[model samples]
Target: MAAAAPAGDDAVAVDVAGVVKSFPGVEALKGIDARILRGRLTGLVGPDGAGKTTLMRLMAGLMAPDAGTIRLAGVDVSHDRDRVAPSIGYMPQRFGLYEDLSVIENLRLYARLRGIAPRRAQPVFERLLGFTRLGPFTSRLAGRLSGGMKQKLGLACALMGTPGVLLLDEPGVGVDPVSRQDLWRMVEALTGEGMAVVWSTAYLDEAERCETVLLLNEGRLEYDGPPAGLTARLHDRSFRLAGPRRDRRQVLSEALGLPGVSDGVIQGDAVRLVLREGGTPDLLAPFAAETGARVEAVTPRFEDAFIDLLGGGPGGTSRLAERMDPVRLETEVTVSCRHLTRRFGTFTATEDVSFEVSRGEIFGLLGPNGAGKSTTFKMLCGLLRPSAGAAEVAGLDLRRATSEAKRQLGYMAQKFSLYGLLSVRQNLEFSAGVYGLEGRVRRARVEEMIETFQLGRHLTGAPGDLPLGYRQRLALACALMHRPPVLFLDEPTSGVDPITRREFWTHINGLVRKGVTVMVTTHFMDEAEYCDRVALMYRSKLIALDTPDALKARVVTRDLPEPTMEDAFIGLIEAHDADREAGA
Candidate 1:
């Protein structure tokens, strides 16, 4: 097999041909071929467990391909990594940043490691600091920087020696949208300077911005073309349906059930739907009339095409019970925070934050990285003590009756928190037992969860060995084993693909229908639209709270187009900052 030709006259920075890589029980890549070029951005994209990482490692010369050749700057990297090392800069998803070192110190250290003289390194440092907009923070400890800043610093270090090819793996996963735009600007600038960039991301929107894309799934290359070509496949097959605000979920549920509707998700106050082949607009007319929903033809996005390529629609019946066992609606507020304030010495993580979540509501907490959203979530979950103010979970004070409050909720941390070494079954059993289940009860609960989450096949497999989507399923299963009324999810779908994210949210919607209360934190603005109401936090203060539609409306002005959730979020933050500055 031969690698594809580079676009136009641009030189190929890395050429991969018939690359195959296998782990113990899986073939991560099978006969993969791609030609990444200088002066261009090649998007390496796919769903979870699509072998993107394996291919990246192989290209980076960090791992040997089972079979095939990888050429870096025309040099055989597999056989001569040392020769190719200086020409390639690989930044893994989790960049190795020394927490104790200052930004400039880390850059200088990388320069020294690359055998660059101090005189040569000084100019590189100055250039990187200016490029990354980190000059003011050069003296700050790497650990103290925000998620976006850290990513910039990591990129700066990777470019210390001005490598010809840069491979960045999901650098925008947890960063806010504003910072994400900045990162992309920096990468685009690098490409302008004749450096080739291969960015591996699950974000379809981000992928669409690339010059060319390599779409892989289950170790096989699915599509190798420009993003416009990919999206063009689904032309005129997408539509947006808008109705009464309260009918949003109903609209989504009904749209998914439509015979022609391939896939549907709540986008702001409307439901965006993709139609199956041979499906027509008339097919949706009946539902539209019944629900008072107006349908309009819309342009298909990159996500719509990606989901279509990955087998048009969702699968299997929802595992949740058809109906929720009735809970007494004696109290309206399921979760409440009163003047929640948390301080670490002289720094206030969160200040005077207050909110109330009614029963059966999906409340979203939105903020940029390090905006103190996590601190508020921890306080509400009783994981951290608040310096002042009060919080109650399910009517129980988190500070006072912590145990009682805990029993009323389930929590899924931002990162994978289950024991990686434990088997899927073991983790479920452990969670059940922790919630006080014993003997036959624990066994029954674990089995039920296994069946519910479709984990029977991987029951004996270690959690770490499963795909990211499956790992998420296992984590959710563990969190819900005891069936707590209130659930707290911290960045549940951070790095997952659109398909897996939709699936995860499907289960959450099912649980919500079953009368569960959910509080979630996420950087994905689209996910915020699914919430009944969202609270925007900035600088440790609550800046905006409203339904998604209302929030967007608030942000719309002469300067901005009709706002998406991301625009609304940025608008709210900027407004708050402006107000604070004016007061100061």
Candidate 2:
């Protein structure tokens, strides 16, 4: 219905009708249809494998639809993508970046390719560098930048040609809260200047900020309109419950299973469920009592409503930690480094970095895109050797006792690395064997892990067939097959729903209670609060180290409304940028 029209806007910038794309054995986009109005930021929201990326690639003319048409500024993009290429900028989920080249070098190359004269490009590049507050790091290799900075740099490069339409696919996935704010601010500024943006993300919060949102689930457009309209769907029909926290997922599941219940999803400590028309609490009372939950009426948020619409409500919460305590334990340092150095040619990926992660504690390493967090993590995990200095994990130097040190760690990288051909049980069994767990012990652990992670029903299915959240949980289960003393998670909860993120943490927290130390790297500031301690790194240096609240209190700024971890993070980084800028 023409997307119900935004509050007050008429100009249309992107028009796609009956778009359908298919691969060798996959229907990527099933007759997809959507639009982006002029001067407005439209969000393409979907879960992974929901055709969001495919649609974006089609719109950008990087891929063609089997049956449909796409137009940019009313000109057919599918037919004349080259002619309209100069007026469109498309940034894929994984934008190609050179590790060896400096930040400014990459910008210059893009400008030249876009036909910008040296003198003209110079001014624009300078302005972009300043806008992103990355001027001082111009000479730094792109590989050495932090995750947040890398995203910003990517954005800078995308805007080099001043495209009229910008298509960004999950640009803020692994970005910190402060950087996300900066990104949204930049988008707002561009839209104000009449640029149209089609931003895709798995984060509902980011989608809520868009002028209009297109909700995609399983290759179908579920909702395409304003966020207010989406929220309005629930109205008084939504309800919430908060009492003693008691396994909200389980409670919600049972509540929904009742005759009068329709849908439910857990939100933090509460379970927000929908009731049948004219349904009353008495209908749900027995279900709540049986599920060990105290029911109450609570307002549903956008996330809860979306989950309901998608029919992806929370299932029963497994009693994974029933025998174990839920509280995190504080123990002695399990991993320590002193003056650790790693270099590639003349560039230092990790320069004289030093830190210690306590045993049984959740320690978070926070940084921008290439702030050396991954380098340090690889060193500790014995994947890479340090160029100099000492690096010890589990009381043994990784370089000297790599095998022994590895036995003490269970590592989950940025993406779940599992064979798509293998079933969930097979993957777990393989991991168990690799970790030296064998015989009955191996079989028992594998079974336990699957049960704990709720893979029983999907055990026979290939790992690739599982949902993103399930895949993540399976990876975690595989990592813990050998019951390592320490777990190293690299962006464990990236690109997942907030509810799923919380569920993942619930399991991770369970591990902490069993004297298992967790050293994690993440871009989410809210996740930082869950950490026992946090370290903010920049340019291979540890700048801030403390509990989340303590770090928030340390960095003060007048312009920021609330002094959050995000505010402190940005203020600290900005000040460092200013100092370096002046020095440069």
Candidate 3:
């Protein structure tokens, strides 16, 4: 907002002092104070219901704080909202783009809403289409575009008038790695032009890119500094260890309980353990004997720091069935597909796709949005009939034994897909009924799941009323009501906080140990390492398939010591594209 200010020109872009907002039964946001400096990218990082979204909305002038003052570039938003509205571009967690409209139409509509002249927006739109690589899809309906493309278009529309301040809430949630890279590049370019950007995200890797970060927890500021400052907090303590699969969890748990171990987490094939204040060499020998694991030191990353900060919340439940024989399942080939193809009119969703998932294995299906992972998932679950090809789940043909196949698989869709209107207990009861569970058995199973996930405290509340983490737990409960042997999870952890994601996977690993085969799709690259085997999908085809380490090995051209899964994913995709172009 335009206002008379002190003569000094370098004022804070957005400032909040003692802000508080409350709902009926909860204090959503406690008193909070923070400042976003001019021409820099500031990140809002925290777990679900930490009030990151609320703070962003308050600063964007979308809501009135119960008790506080918020100033944007020296002007108070509460008192001068109308004047400041045009200067701030806000993108909520779920952006609103007309599904029926074309990309061009959506851009034009936003331009008109921002009061930009048609002539002036033309060049801007051209640049946007070029930057997003959406030139060929300009005429396609928004609903037909992939998730990543829609996000890019949303950004293009928000930047129509080139607002001074930009607020993005979880902009990269379901976006693929390459598209995410493009989006961050665009953001970096904008910040170079002196635009203040406030980005909120669930992925810690995304937060690492911010110039400065404000780590919020339950409406309170925990840490505020540059990105490097957060990483510096975990300097000498982090260590990595490698051992047998069955001993991994046992080793981590025993290590955590040791006198010298402050924290221990399983990362890929190793455990990243932080030493306690008075830890000594004598502690290691007894701890190794207790867990029967071989330990070694390694470099610590941001994930280790995050787990340490969350303290003792949820993790390591996966050790439940690891002590038992993991390969004693009823079915040998849990799921098998041959030349699977699905078509909607002339468009091929998945063409000649083939893959196999073994019993008691965690298999990952990695892909960009619109790469047909969901389509293939639906076909495997018997929700959709493939146009051609044959598939069998748990030894039953999907087409011939639809109902029988459904009984052998549990599916968690992209959306939590639980009824928001139904309470947690009500949803569980309904799900049990669908699986043909009777009154007594249904109640028993429901109670067991509730206790296992620690949901007794909120079972009476509506599923929608619970936070993101609780809702995910509830959905998984419903899916596993019948104890299906194979589970299909489509972006199961999308838009969830890092801590919650870690907890969710901890439960998932527990299931895998009990001989439940899992086929999952996800956007977070770090998660790829957790799966036993991973398949990278592009343009409805499987580009690469192997263990996470093997996939990374395919892309190793240099002797870089710490090449992460993200690096390998991008590198493989690039080489695949290059080979495709040469063949074409």
Best by TM-score: 1
lDDT of 2 by residue, 299-416 (tens): 5456656665765444433355444443332437788999989998898888888878877778899887668888888888999888997888888778789998898898998867
Q: Write the per-residue lDDT of candidate 3 for residues 356-450, one digit (tens) a residue.
A: 89987889999878788999999999988999999999999988899988987889998778888888888988999999999787788888778
**Top lDDT model:** 1
Ranking by TM-score: 1, 3, 2
Candidate-wise lDDT, in order? 0.86, 0.77, 0.80
Worst 10 residues of 2 by lDDT: 1-10
- Where does model 2 exceed 4 Å of error? 1-10, 116-120, 235-300, 316-363, 367-402, 415-430, 439-477, 497-503, 509-517, 529-584
Instruction: Report model 1's TM-score to 2 decimal places.
Output: 0.95
Model 2 RMSD vs true structure: 6.3
Off by over 4 Å in 3: 1-11, 245-265, 275-294, 318-329, 457-461
Candidate 1 residue pairs that clash: none
Deviation from native of the Cα of residue 484 in model 2, angstroms: 2.4
Better by TM-score, candidate 3 or 1 = 1
